[model samples]
Target: MATPRIDLTAAAMLLGLAAVWGGSFVFAEIALRELGPMTITLHRVGWAAPLLFVLVRLKRLALPRGWRIWGSYLVMGALNNAIPFTLIFWGQTALEGGLASILNATTAVFGAVVAGLLLRDEPLLPRKLIGAALGVLGVAVVVGADALGTLSLRNLAQLAVLAAALSYALASVWARVRLGDQPPLVNAFGMIAGSTVLMIPAALWSDGLPDLGLAPVTWAALAGLSLLSTVLAYLLYFAILRRAGAANLTLVTLLIPPFAIFLGWLVLGEALPASAWIGFAVIALGLLVTDGRAARALAARYFLHTVTKE
Candidate 1:
C-alpha cells in the first residue's frame, strides 16, 4: 500500500508547526548561552509538561493508567524529546542555527526509509527517495550549498545533530506503531511527562543547579522554547503524525527553514535574497514530488494537451 499523504488541514498544521519549530533553533541558541544542554533540554520538556496537563484537563482527556503505555511513552519521550533535545542543544553550541536546521532536515529522508522498513503499510523506498533527495538538496541550497561542507573538529556536533534527526525519525514510527490507540493529547502529555521525569535527574547530575538569576532575554528565550516550541509543537506534531503518517510528517523539517526565512521577512521586515526565494520554490517542488499528485496533474494537462494538438 502507498503511504498516506498529508491533506490540506494537515499541511496547514505542518506549516504552522514548522514555523514554531524553526524558532526553536533560535530559542535554544539563546537559552544555551547561559544554560547547559541538559538543563535546556530539561526546561523545554519540564515546563511544557504542565501546560499540556492543563490543556488535557480542559479537554477532559483521560490519562493513561497502564504501565505498558507509560513505558512506551518513556521511549517516545527519549526518542522525541530527551535524546534529540540534548543532542541538538549541544550541537548548536558549535554550529550555526541554520546549519543545525539543515542537518536536522535529514529526518525527512530518514523517516522515509525507517517508516518503509518498519511500518508494513508505508510505501516502499522507491516512491519516497526522489523527494527525500530533493528535499535534502533544497535544504542545502536554502542554507547555501557550502554549509554542509564546512568541516572542523566540530564534525562531532554535525554527527550529533544527525543522530538527533535519526531519533526524530524513529520516534515518528514508534508513535505510529506503539501509541496509535491513545489520544494525541494523552500521548503528548505522557511523552512530555516521561521526558520531564528523565530530564530532571539528568540535568541536576550534569548541570548541578541552574542559576536562578537569569538574564531577561534568556528567560524570554526559555519561555518561548517551552510554551511555543514544546507545548504547541507537541500538539501539532501528534496531530500531523495521526493525519499524515510518519514519512509525510517528517517533511515538516524540510519546510522549517523556508518558514523561518519567510517569518524573518514578514515580521522583522528583513529582505529576502534571491536564494531564499529560490530555495522556497525548490522546497515546494520537492514536496510536490513527494506528494506525487501535482506531477500527475501536470502530466495529464500538458502531455494530453500536446498529444491532442499533435
Candidate 2:
C-alpha cells in the first residue's frame, strides 16, 4: 500500500493544531500571573473535559464501559494530560513560553525513540539515533551547559519541559496499545475526564481551591487555553491523525514553536536569545532527520506541488 500524503485540508488542520497547541504555552503564561501552575493545569483539563464529553455525546459515540478501558484512560490521562500539562505549566513559570515550546519540540524526537524501543513496528533506525543526539544537543544549546552544573530553578524548569515531552511520547504509545480500538472522540473525552478527576485534588492540595475572581484578561486566557488549545486542538488532532496517518501528524511538532515564539513576542514582549533560535532550528532538523527525509527532496516536492496546483 502506498503512503498517504497530507493534502491541503489536512495540512491546514495540522497548522491549526500547531497554532493552538503552541498558544497553550502563552495561555499558561498569562494564567500563571494569577493562578498556580497546578491550578492552571487543572483548569485546562477540568474545563476541556466537559466540553469534550458534550462533543462525544453529540457525536453519539459509544463510551467504553469497561473498567479496564477506563483504567487505561486514567493512565493515559496521567501521562498525556495531568503530568505533562502540570510540568509544562510549571516549567513556564520559570522558562520563557517561547523557549519552553522550543524545548517541547523535542517531543517528536523522543517520541520516535520511545516508540522504537517500546513498539515492535517502530524499530530503532540509525537516523533516529542521530536525530535523538541532535535533539539532545539542541536542548543543551538552548539551556546551556551551565544548567548541568547546578540544580537551579531555571535549569529544573528546562528539565521539566523535556520531561513533559517524554510524557507525551509515552502517552502516544499507550494510546496506540490500549485505546486504539476506541473511537477517537471517546478516547479524547475519556482521557480528559480521567485527568480532570486526578487534577482536582492535586490542584486543591497543592494550590488550595482556586480563586474565582480574576482579571478579565486572565479569564480570557483560561478560556482560550481550555477551549481552543485543548478541546478544539484535540478535535483537530484526531481528525488529522485519521486523515493523514500518524507519521504525517508528527509534522505538527515542528510547526508549534514558531507560533509560540511569535505569540510570546507579539503579545508579551518576550524576546529569545539567538541560541534559542539556533536550537529550535537544530531540533527541527533532528525531527526531519528522524522522519528520514532529505530536506532537499521534501522542499522540492513541496515546491513542485505548489507549482502544479498553481
Candidate 3:
C-alpha cells in the first residue's frame, strides 16, 4: 500500500489547528492560577460540548446513534480530551508554558511510532526512526543536561506532559481506525460530549464544585480554551485527519512549540534559554527527515541521472 499524502489545504488547516492548540498552553497556565486542573478540563469540555452540538445542528449533520458509537466516543474522549487536558494542565502548574509545549511535541514522535505499529500503510521507514531519535535528542537538549541529573517533581511533571502527548497519539490512531468515515463535526461533538460526562465528576471528586466567582481574566481564558482550542480546534482536527493520515496529522505537534513559545514570552513573560532554540532547530530538522520528501526527491534526481547516462 502507498503512504497517504496530505494536500496543501489540509496542511494549512493542520497549522491553524496547531496555533490554536499552542495558545491553549498559555490559556491553561492562566486559568490554573484560579482553578484546579480537573476543573479546567471540566469547564473546557463542558463549555465546548454544547457549542459543538449547536454547530452540528446548524450544519444539519446526523449524529451516529447507538451505544457502540457512543462507547467509541467515550474512549476517544478519554484519550483525546479528558485525560490529556487534565494531565497537561497539572503539568503546566509545575512547568513553564514553553517547556510544556516543547514536551507536548513528543506527540508526533509517539504518533509516528504508534502509526507505524498499528497502521499498515504508514510504515516506520528508516528516515522516521532517525527523525524520532533526533527529536528525542532535541527534547533532551531543550530540557537541559543538568536538569536530567535529578529526578525531581518537576521532572515527573514533564513526564506527565509526555504521557499526555502519548495519549493524543493513541487517540489519533483510534479515531483513524474507528471513526475515519464519520463527519468531522459529529465526531467532534460526540467526543467533547463524552469528555464532559467524564470530566464533570472527575472535577467534583478532585476539586469540589468550581468557584462561581472567578475573575474576568480567568473566565476569558476559559472561553478561549473551550471555544477556540477545544471546539474549533477539534473541528479542524477531524477535518484534517480525514485528508491526512494519523502520522501526517501529528506533524502539527512539530509546529506548535514556536507559536507556544511566542505566546508564552509575549503574554506570560517566559523566556527560553539558548539550548531551547537549538533543540527546536534540531526538532525541525527531524521533522523534515521524518517527512521524507527531500530524500525522495534526491533519489528521483539520481535515478534520472543514471537513466540519462545509460
In order, candidate lDDTs are: 0.80, 0.92, 0.87
1-310, model 1: which lDDT tens digit per residue? Answer: 6567788999899998998898888788788879999999999998999899999999998897878999999999999999999999999888666556666766665576778778899875565777677766665565565657786646778778878988998998999899989888888899999999999999999999878899999999899899999888878887888788865775776678766555544543545457645655565565567667667788899999999999
Off by over 4 Å in 3: 1-15, 238-251, 301-310
Full-model lDDT, candidate 1: 0.80
Task: Report the Cα lDDT for residue 253, model 2.
Answer: 87
TM-score of 2: 0.93
> Where in model 1 is the C-alpha error above 4 Å?
1-15, 132-151, 236-251, 261-288, 302-310
By TM-score: ranked, best first: 2, 3, 1
Evaluated with lDDT, which candidate comes out highest?
Answer: 2
Tens-place lDDT digits, model 2, residues 141-249 = 9988777888999998999999999999999999989998988899889999999989999999999978989999999999999999999999899889878998899
Better of 1 and 3 by TM-score: 3
Note each model's CA RMSD in angstroms: 4.4, 4.0, 3.0
